[model samples]
Every structure is written in C-alpha cells, then in structure tokens.
Target chain A: QQPVQSPQAVILREGEDAVINCSSSKALYSVHWYRQKHGEAPVFLMILLKGGEQKGHEKISASFNEKKQQSSLYLTASQLSYSGTYFCGTGFKAAGNKLTFGGGTRVLVKP
Target chain B: EAGVAQSPRYKIIEKRQSVAFWCNPISGHATLYWYQQILGQGPKLLIQFQNNGVVDDSQLPKDRFSAERLKGVDSTLKIQPAKLEDSAVYLCASSLVFQGLNEKLFFGSGTQLSVL
Candidate 1:
C-alpha cells in the first residue's frame, strides 16, 4: 500500500521553508526520503528509523514517529536547486526490504 | 563507488512493439530491484532479486513483463507487446542487503520510454 503525502505540491521562493509529510495506514519501521530531479535517478536524502532518531543533511532534515507511523521532511532555506519531486518510501512492519512508496510531492524553489 | 547502471537512456516505440532494458548493479551488491515510475508518481516496484534468485514479483505483470538476473550480476526486464500505459521511466536500484532496517537503495539514471 502506498502512503499518502500532504501538500501535493509547493512553490517557494529562495530562502523559504517547507514541510512535507508522509503518512501510512500501516505502522512503519523506518522511512526513507529521496529527491528526484527531472530525468534523473532518485537520490537518498535521509532515513529516519523508529524511536525518534534524527538525521540531518545540509538544509534537509527528517523525523520519524513510531507511534504514529508518520514521517516528515524539513527543507529550510530552500534554494533554486531544491526544485524536484520528493518521495517518502516506507518499510512496513511485516515486510523485509520491501519498501512501498507514497505519491510524491513536487517542490519548486524559485528565485 | 559506482551506482546502478541502466542501458538505453531513452526509447520511443509504438504500441504492440517489444522492448527490453538492462541493469548492472553496484559491485558486491546482493539485491537488485526494478521499478516503474509513471509520470508525476513515485516508482512502483516491479520485481526484486537477491543474488540471481527472485525475491519478489507480486507487482510485476507476469503475462507481458518478465525479468531475470543471471549469474547474480546483470539483469534485464523485457516487455512484450508493449501498451501505451507501459510508457514510463523504468528505474533500476540496488541495495547491499535484502533484509534489516538500515538498508539504503542506490539508483541508476532511469530509462525514459515513450510508447507511441
């Protein structure tokens, strides 16, 4: 089952901030965040495992809530280079390395 | 380290035609996966392999779509009698392991297919 993403698309000016949410009906053990620019492969941004372990990469950050089965990605001080599609892939409880992805959220950071 | 490699950066074919895409995963990687990403959507897993043995194909359209990883190295996905709906970017990814919670996927620049 695919997760659901909120704020399907967002447009931001440079130096703006945005939050993308990924929620799944089933509980997830971990959540992986990736960004895919046009015509390119999806690149891993970060992975948030259960128990509220946080990982940050430059201006990108993410958090996972084990109890709620949700993950959120934070993009602070967005730049034009941030324009791309953000996807959240969830590792379900019963599955092993079988991640089901959510409908992506498109972000456009303009000057 | 080199990431997954996919052949045919782009393809254009008419409906009812057949096409195949190849993938070479990162060296020493044990798991490889093929995904179909429709426009404006996240990729959907078509098949997954662990060291030349199929681990998953529940989502794959077995009738016209098939994949194989021979010698636990390179892989190929073939679609016979392609349909318009099959026009999507096919992505290949690999991971070091097929189990556990800390695994990460490395992807290749996908093949963009336009079935006319």
Candidate 2:
C-alpha cells in the first residue's frame, strides 16, 4: 500500500524551515525521498534505513522512526531551488526490493 | 554518468488505441522500474525489473499493459486498447543494484501520454 504524506502543500520564504512527514501502515524497512520539479524527473534526495543509517545529499537530511513506521524530511533555511514536489517511498520487508511511494507534498519556497 | 533515457517525450492517442514507451537505463545499472504518475499524485510503481527478469508487476494492469526488459539494458512498456484513464506520465528509473531497495534511483524525464 502507498504511504501517506502530511501537509499536501506548503509555502515558505527563503531562510524558513519546514517539515514534511510520511507514514505507512505497514512496517517499513527503509524510506526514500525524492524531489520533482514541474516537467522534470524526480531526483533522489535521501534514504533512511530502518537501523538509522541515512545517506543522500549533504545539505538535505531526514529522520526515520522505525517503531512508528514514519519518516520526516527537514528543509531548513529553505532555498528557492527547493521548490518542488516531495515524495517519500517506503520499502517493506515482505515486498522485497519494491519501493512504494506516497502521494507527495508540494513545497514552494519563494525569494 | 549518463542518466536514464526515455523516448517520445509526449504521446496522444484515442481510447482503445495502442501506445508504447521506451527506456534505456544507465550503462551499469542492474535494476529498472516503471511508474505512472497522474496529475497531482505521486508516481506509482507499475513494474520492476532486475536484469531482464521481472521482480514485481503486481500494480500493472495485465489486461492492457505489458512490459519487457530485453538484454537487461533497455525496456519497453506497451498499453494496448488504452483507456482515457491511462493518461499520465510514465517514468523510468534505474538503480545501480538490487541492494535491498536502499540504493538511490536515477530517473528519466518521462513520457507524457494523453488518451482522448
């Protein structure tokens, strides 16, 4: 099943901070984040593993709570380049290597 | 590295018509995925391939959709007798390996399909 994302849309000014949350009903082994600009492909952002291992862009960070089956993406000091749709893909042990994505959260960071 | 490549940036067809999209993954990547993204929605996984073999296709509509990754380098997704609801963007992505779904994926620009 697809995960759920909170705050479907958010608007922020430069230098502001925002948080996007993703939750899945099924136990997740890992969570992957990506950003997609209009008319472009989704770009890989970060991945948070169940054991707390995180890897991705140096400037971007995210946290995964294994017990809750939730993950959150933190956008601090937002930049104009951060404006895009954010998606969280969840991986379940039973599903093997398939990653199921969430509905997505749209973020607009203005100058 | 060269990113994943997709053909036919845009396609339009009438209901019941057939349409096909093609994708070429990164040179050394061993895993490929196809996803469908509707307006205002996230990309939904349609199928997954691990070196020319299907790993998952539970979300694919077998009644009208079929896909193949020949030679483990390139793939094609075909929708026959397409329905209006099939209008969306088809995205192709690839990862270096099938490492427990933890590897990052590189995506292609995607093909936009419109069914009238």
Candidate 3:
C-alpha cells in the first residue's frame, strides 16, 4: 500500500527548519527520501533502514521508526536550493523489497 | 557512472492512440523499474525487472500497458488505446542490486505524456 505523507506543502525562509512525515499502515523495511526540482528528475537524498537508523545529507536528516511504521525528514537552515517536491518511498521488504512511493510534499524555500 | 536515460522528453497523443517510452539503465545494473507520476503525485511503480526477467507488475494495467527489458540493458513501456487518464510522466529508474531494498535509485528525466 502507498504510505501517507503529512503537510502537503510547506514554505520556509533561509535558515529556517521544517519537518516532513511519512507513515505506512504496514511494517516497512526501509524509507528512502528524494527531492525533485521543477522539471527535473528526483535526486536521492537519504534512506533510513530499521528503527533508530538515521541518515543525513548535509543539513538534511531522516529517522526511521519501525514500531510506528513512520519516517521523518528534517531540513535545517533551509536554502533556496532546497525548494523542491520531497518524496518518501516505503519498502515492504518481501523477497525483493520493491519500493512504493507516497504522494510527495512540496517545499518552497525562499530568501 | 551515468544515470538512467529516457527518450522523447515529451509526447502528446489523442485518446485511443498508442505511445511508447524507452529507457536505458545504468550499465551492469540488474534492477530496472518503470513508474508513472501524475501531476502533483509521487512516482508510482508500474513494473520491475530483474535482469530482463519480470519480477513484479501488480500496479500495471495489463489491458493497455506492457513493458519489457530485453538483454537486461534497456527497457520499453508501451500503452495501447491510451485513455485520457493515462497522461502522466513516465520515469525510469535503476539500482545496483535486485534485493537491496535500501539501495539508492537513479532516475531519468522522464517522458511527459499528454493524452487529449
């Protein structure tokens, strides 16, 4: 099943902080985060596997909560370059563990 | 290493017509995927291939959608009798491993399909 993401869109200023959440009804083996600029392909940011595993890329970090079947992405000191649509792909981890992406959260970072 | 490559950045077709999208995955990558992303939505996996063999296609509409990855290097997704709802961006992605769920995915620019 597709995971559910909160706060469909968010606006932030330079040096500001924001959080995006992704939740799944079933247990997830991993959660991958990606950012896509307008008219561009999505770029891989980080992936959180299992509970307590934290992944970071510069000022962006993500944590996986296995018990809650949720993942959270944190953006610190947002920059204009951070403006993009963020997507969370949840993996159920069967034999192959195919990733199923959730509806994205749009982030607009301004000066 | 080069990322996934897709052709015909954009396509426009009338309803009931047919369209195809091509993808060239990163060399040596055994896992390839095709996704459909509607405006304002996330990329939805349409099919997956493990070295030219079918793995999963639960989300693909078998009646009108078909995909193949011959020689395990490139893939093609075709839609026949396309409907208005079929308009979306077709994205191609590849990974280094077939069972590594957390591995990074490399995506292509995607083909924008517009059905009138």
lDDT of each: 0.91, 0.92, 0.92
Which stretches in model 2 have alpha-carbon errors above 4 Å?
A53-58
Fraction of true inter-chain Cα contacts (below 8 Å) kept per model? 0.67, 0.78, 0.84
Q: Model 1 reaches what TM-score against the true structure?
A: 0.97
Can you give the DockQ of every candidate in the order shown?
A: 0.75, 0.80, 0.84
Candidate 2: tens digits of C-alpha lDDT, residues A1-111: 899999999999999989999999988898999999999999999888889764546556798888888998988888999999999999888877688889999999999
lDDT of 3 by residue, B1-116 (tens): 78789998999999999999999998989999999999999999999999999899988999999999999889999999899999999999999978477689999999999999
The TM-score of the first chain in every model comes to: 0.95, 0.94, 0.95
Local error of candidate 3 at residue B19 (angstroms): 0.8
Model 3 earns a TM-score of 0.97
RMSD to the true structure for each prediction, in A, is 1.1, 1.2, 1.1
Writing each residue's lDDT as its tens digit, candidate 2 over B1-116 gives 78999999999999999999999999999999999999999999899999999998999999999999999999999999899999999999998988476788899999999999
In model 3, the runs with Cα more than 4 Å from the true position are none
